[model samples]
Target: MQANIRHQVSPYLVFFLIYNSQVGVGILSFQRTIAAKAGYDAWIGVLAAGCIVQVFIWVMYKLLGKANGDIIDVHTNIFGNVLGKFISFFIMIYYWLASVSVLIAFIEIIQVWMFPTMPSWILSTLILFSVYYCVSGGFRVIVGMSFLSFIFPQILIIVLFIFPLKIAHFSNLLPIMNHSFMDMADSIKSSIYSIAGTEALLMYYPFIRDPKASKKFAHLGVLFTTFLYTISTIVSFTFFSENQLKTTIWPELSLTKTVTLSFLERFEYLYISMYLIIICALIALFLWCSSRGLKKIFNRKQKYTLLLLCLLSVILCHFNGSFKDMLNKYIIQMNLWIFYCYIPILLLVLSFIKRGKQNDE
Candidate 1:
């Protein structure tokens, strides 16, 4: 299922997609989650996880390049249509649930910080409206939103970290390896959800012009975000004490409290407001991938698939609570197993099958 030439985007744009996809709600609160056990040493685990992601990027290209299409193409080629679409459906479900997880996470932030009495459905519907618009324009528009996300709010957000550094205790990161190896593993495990969006590439491979040339850019994108998150982790760790971070729900957002000026007050309100662009772009990318994958598997129009997905996302967001937790738990486990563990093995099996076919021919 090669995308039409007009539907395709420049290979370099993949960097923006990969970067924006991974930069979702996790960054605001991940510092506390990773530090839950590893304490200050968790930043090291982030670096290690970045290295592993780079390796995973290599594995994805090897597999997708061989298939010359998205994951659905590879599945049908190897598993036959009936069994393949069945498996692909589950992957699409994961992508859909992933978008919902990100959606509710931001809604929770807005309700807590800005509008305590606002209903979840109102915010969720407003967000999905933007997501539907971008996704309806096709993959290129989604990628463009990603590009804007990096340029606008992302740059400004990165600059905001400087204010926190003025009061940072760099010495807090001392004795980095003080924790046991198992503790480091726990930190890495927690960071996985924050850094997990790279796997969205599985569905969009065919939409990139000259995907081979795009591979380096994808790795670079991951590298940049990894560095970004690591720095964020260090900033959060340095700004707050170990015990304080544990109690803090959104450490990075709280860091905005330090930014004060005579002209303005309660910077976190402004901070959360600016974050709307970033959140919308991330949700658009994930929903695009999910809808596209389901469209291919079901042989349906993408608009119908996308609309169905948007409606489901709103419904799921409205029912937030234990459901959000359950959704995230499933997504993280599927991400780890489906991409990290299964993809490399799939590459090996694909290589063998291609070899056998060549011999028979």
Candidate 2:
């Protein structure tokens, strides 16, 4: 059930893969979204959500580790091939649509900031071309892209947070926990969706060279991203007044506006450009999961499946005038329920089934 040795990656790379998957276009605007319900207390909600994600990570590892393969294997072993693939088809489609959602969100950013007149198809096609190239090279290549995404932009982006801190109104976060428990719950809910993509680990479990050894690295990866997000939420909360943050979109990108250099007066442009690495890496990983799942389910060639997905993604983006909002909403709900709710139930059921089989044997 394990992937071939040549196709597997080092255990440590789990950190970068988790990092790449979690950090995407959501980071750009999540502050305002989380703040809407809980006011300044939303950062605490973010930490809470991260805790939930850590628990979910533990669940996924336990489930996938027992199967010793991807979710597809888990499904087939439990449900028989037909019904298992029937259920798994929904998850695969979720992966493909998740990639498209990221694609459209980033494309919207490019249109607004970088290219006002550029067509959606052109941008979608351009980005997917890079994603296809990386993904077609196989899982190792996708992980390589993830590693590059982590190394190149992350440290520099963290340094950029200093610019906003210079003028940050730290008192804006005073009188914390002012929001009601209900409001805090709302904020945590929003934060959970924003910090999603860790569930991508389920599909790629077998590709880890030593899945057991990688468990700590996987938890470490989520721990790192949780802190990254909490720090980002704190920075955004301090830098913008409650009212101002509510009004602004892309507050993280706005923070970059404070960053000025002798060579570069417009740093947000560079910020968006650098984000291509993070965004493309995410798209590549999601599509790899989607296409690989489909290949296994249908016994079809992976290349054909991947190419069809890229084409469908492009077509969806081109016609995305009204569908964008709906797409995001659907994917958000799907990520929350499927990964958080149904996945845990699945783990429970799988444990019972495996135990019963062992007793029978």
Candidate 3:
């Protein structure tokens, strides 16, 4: 069901939702992954990935405009009711897995970097519990949380990068095109997952007041995210040698170690603690999208679906570290296919069907 007037968010809030959702755990280690493929030209890959995501955003808007509803309605409109529900079920599963991936990935970061002795299950339970609380409040609460999440970490985190510039070697980015075109193309493909998550717009599009007016704000959000990622990639490239950059798992976090203050011995500890807000926003958004999809398909209450998905995520988080890694890898691959391939084809099919109906009329 479409959100009522009281529940609908202002179009401008789309800026925060799109931006915050795209900047989660992936950005932390993306430098290493992209650098391994394109060397110092990884920033270019980031820019290219942003452009690609923008095109997908446009396509999604067009499709939603035609359906005049969310993805569940689109499926049911184009396919018969039985097949559409079947397809919608798989989409819900994908959203559920995406939420679980974000949850477990953040827990792993806390275990390794923040508190080595903290058990995964304990943190998982706590995080999912918070997700349950926020999501049960409804769409408006989730939008408020997304807005806070974007504002809190962005300025402080970007400011920390200034310290790294003291040691930066701008020359590292020289011979920028040394890598083959194919190499850069590979890097862009790798960067897709880091840029993934904007697809949540499909689920939430119907909840925006004056959904058409939200387009520019949504584009602005993507542009802002792209700029942030490009700058971070450039800083990471210049701050570390090519070999050093390739070896470092979380280059952005490592860059923080270069900062020092009179009272704080390790600034990254504070940074990581503050970063939990960003991670919480991410988990909450994905969980909300999944539960919303469930509610739409089953015509059930969203709170019940929210409780079910949150508990399911907590259970899955208890698996071994290796299983978590494999799951993350699979989720990224699925995202690449779903956004790049499936959305485009679905758009084409919907357009043709609409055209045929018009001709018949």
Candidate 4:
């Protein structure tokens, strides 16, 4: 007999998972990526991007709640049978690609910081299997795992900021708007990429115990995430010169190296070791969401579909050239527009249209 699975995530847990997932390895590289384009005003660019993302998340939740359906049903109502299926299929593909790219990026980060001698294929497969195992266990299990993963964030924040009074120079963040607004605008695309994972809300909406609570939690979650991000960014900037920071690939980790603790020669290693848990949780969340998206769009068997997604992501990770370069070419560009602007605007329009039709009827 098939077992009936229920979504057991509370609003707070939902908030944690979404917030943590959004604050992944992307934060490690965001400063350099955006600073390259926006100069010292990258924080301003990130703020602008956050505002846009919040509006988009609001619009998405409104549309999804109004339609009161999964992604497939939402699209079907908005675009009609054929076109809706087409669009839903497009979204499904997008989610899959995003999941794969995130997985590859996480692996690349590990390779760079911790395991230089490990083979990429072995690392990729191990991580993919771990993600798939959690995903196959169902949403409640994954959310539960996410709550436990919260330990990593607690440890990370504490380790990195304990002696905060001594290590950093606050002046690095001042005179922040030294660059033109035009430069900030040019870098908005990359800033959007750094905070890109929140769109997972579109897929996980139905799992939220009280759908109505999503808006409240999502807003609160975004606020909290922004606060943490800004603090972390400021700390990193304050610790390293803009010129030195630009050369570091993962400035977050590099900044952690400044921390001095008893019984610890290299705290960054401990931080990285703990961060592996956080990244694993993120991978599980993304993989599960991606699988659910495919099942919703195509009416596929969930188990088989998730397995297929895991295999596909592993394959994508193996594609030639640097994972960073591949992500820039494909996932970053694709999601920069889709997650940041297009999908959100589209959802707003759909929500308006659906409400209008209901009132008319």
Candidate 5:
């Protein structure tokens, strides 16, 4: 299915799409998780992970540039048709799993912190339906939604973080590099899940008006996400001691509790509401990618594929129990392997193949 010229988004929207995708629920809790592994120097791990992501983005652009198409075409170019379709089918499943995981996770958060009495399935239905609406409108609508997601919450959220400074102990960040190199490396590995979203570019690149011009903007998105994560890590590290951080699940959310306003109490509640916009943007992007993959692999319409995926997401969200946590952990592990290990290997294979073909010419 060729993307219509009327439907293609501008090159610069790539920045918002990549940035919104990367800065999801992961940023809210990543500090504690990484700090648990590397101690105070975990902020270093954030920087390292960002740099690693930049490299992967470069590799992805090179691969896509060679194929002159999306990842489906890349696979078909590298592997034969039958094998490529099989691999792309698995990628569709991977994208579905990612959508389900994000939906369930955000539902759990709302249930725990905002509305304990509300049924999980109700929120799940609402959220999935919203995602379906945006995705069914096509890629341009998804891009517009992502732009709003990036602009709406960012300024207020960053301002809220400033309140924590009254109680922040900058001294908590002292003795930096106190952790062993191996520990910091482990933290970087752990941080990969939080930084995993840029790989979506492999699938969406062909939809951009000028795919080549978007490369730098895409890298800028990664840089922007890295800056946000680094700032969050440093703030969390400064606001809480090592032991305190290890115990806090959502350190960023918890930090909002310290903010006192004249008219509003429980500022975290407002923050959570604002966060739904980001979550919606994330789920929409994943679902769109999944549906588009299905269309490519099976010669089906995206509308039907999107409806199927949205229903599946709602079902998964409703039935998710203790297993939800396990599934999330496994998805993170899969993402780490897929983006870090598999993509690089694929790039090398494509490079060698291109060189051999050039020699034959």
Candidate 6:
């Protein structure tokens, strides 16, 4: 049966999914990682890395769009038959495993920060069900949910600035760039870390209504998300001291704790709830893309493909050592490799062959 490629998503909706997916739980932890390397200068690394990511996004879009297909299709066309299928299989595994690791990390964060007493199985079940629900509806619905979640969570972030009005310690951001250029470059790595979801644009390209607008939408999404990351990091640092910031795991939550209103006490709870929605969308979207990759590689039906992959991912999530251990050992390291080494080389090979074929033509 032919795949259902209807219900095209708008540029705005695409932007929302890309931004929200990239901004997932990483923002909460990244400040410390970046800060540790560059100190107060980490924000600079983030902005610089944001610019570099835009270039990577452009290269990705051009290469993937040349195939007018998903990553699997792109790989197959460039590599051909056996070698192509083998490569596609590796790509599919990489994508699915990455999604599982992120989902597991989200559950672990919720357990530690939001609900210490909650069972891990229960949390994982809820997340899996939510992801399945979104995945079943397809990419357009998933993107719509992303737009909704982005607005509310961002509004809460805007409200958070009010806390910095009184509690902010501007001195914490001093000694700027005290670290060497290499150190700043090192700091920027974490920013690039969370920027994973923008690669979704490749799988998502087929769903865009106006193909001409695809590249513009993706770049704008990157810019907007980078702005959000910078502002949020700046505000978080302003509100907490260097010593306090270093000690804190999730400084964004710490930034929210200063918020007090007549109705609510702990704002982080609301933040966590909204955040889970974005995280769920990210996992669902990634899983959907990975399923698409599998279908292209094996030539299978989408429905059956997704079902099988989802089951496999659910099992993988459960069997993990722990989300943190998985991230530290495998996920974080592997993700960088996927983007920087795997993707770039793949694109370069495609570009060279495509040009050679054009010359022959």
Which candidate leads in TM-score? 2
Q: What ordering of candidates by lDDT runs from best to worst? A: 2, 1, 3, 5, 6, 4
What TM-score does each of the candidates earn? 0.98, 0.98, 0.97, 0.91, 0.97, 0.92
* Candidate 6 lDDT by residue in tens digits, 113-205: 788888767777778787888888877778877887777777887887777768677787886767898888888887788666777766767
Question: Candidate 1, TM-score vs. the true structure?
Answer: 0.98
lDDT of 2 by residue, 1-361 (tens): 8999999999999999999999999999999999998999999999999999999999999999788889999899889999999999999999999999999999989998999999999999999999999999999999999999999997668767988899988899999878799999999999998989998998999899999999899889999999999999999999999899989989898888888788887888888898999999999999999999999999999999999999999999986667988998999899989999999999999999999999999
Q: How many pairs of residues in model 2 come into backbone collision?
A: 0
Alpha-carbon lDDT of model 1:
0.89
Please, what are the lDDT tens digits per residue for candidate 5 over residues 151-262? 9899767777798887889988888888888999889987878877887887888888888899999999999999989988888888988888878888988888888999
Listed per model in order, the count of residue pairs whose N, CA or C atoms clash below 3 Å is 0, 0, 0, 0, 0, 0
TM-score of model 3 (CA atoms): 0.97
Off by over 4 Å in 4: 1-5, 320-323
Per-residue lDDT for 44-162 in model 1, tens only?
A: 99999899999999999999999999998888888999898898899888888888899999999999999999999999999899889989998888888899888887655765799
Candidate 6 achieves a global lDDT of: 0.77
* Candidate 1, superposed: residue stretches over 4 Å from native: none
Worst 10-residue lDDT window for candidate 5 reads 1-10
Model 4 RMSD to the real structure? 2.8
Query: Every model's Cα RMSD, please?
Result: 1.1, 0.9, 1.2, 2.8, 1.3, 2.3
**2 or 6, which is superior by TM-score?**
2
Q: Provide the global lDDT of candidate 2 against the true structure.
A: 0.93
C-alpha lDDT of all candidate models, in order: 0.89, 0.93, 0.87, 0.73, 0.87, 0.77
Q: Candidate 4's residue-wise lDDT over 301-344, tens digit each?
A: 77888888777777777774675586667777777666666777
Ten residues in a row with the worst lDDT in model 6?
1-10
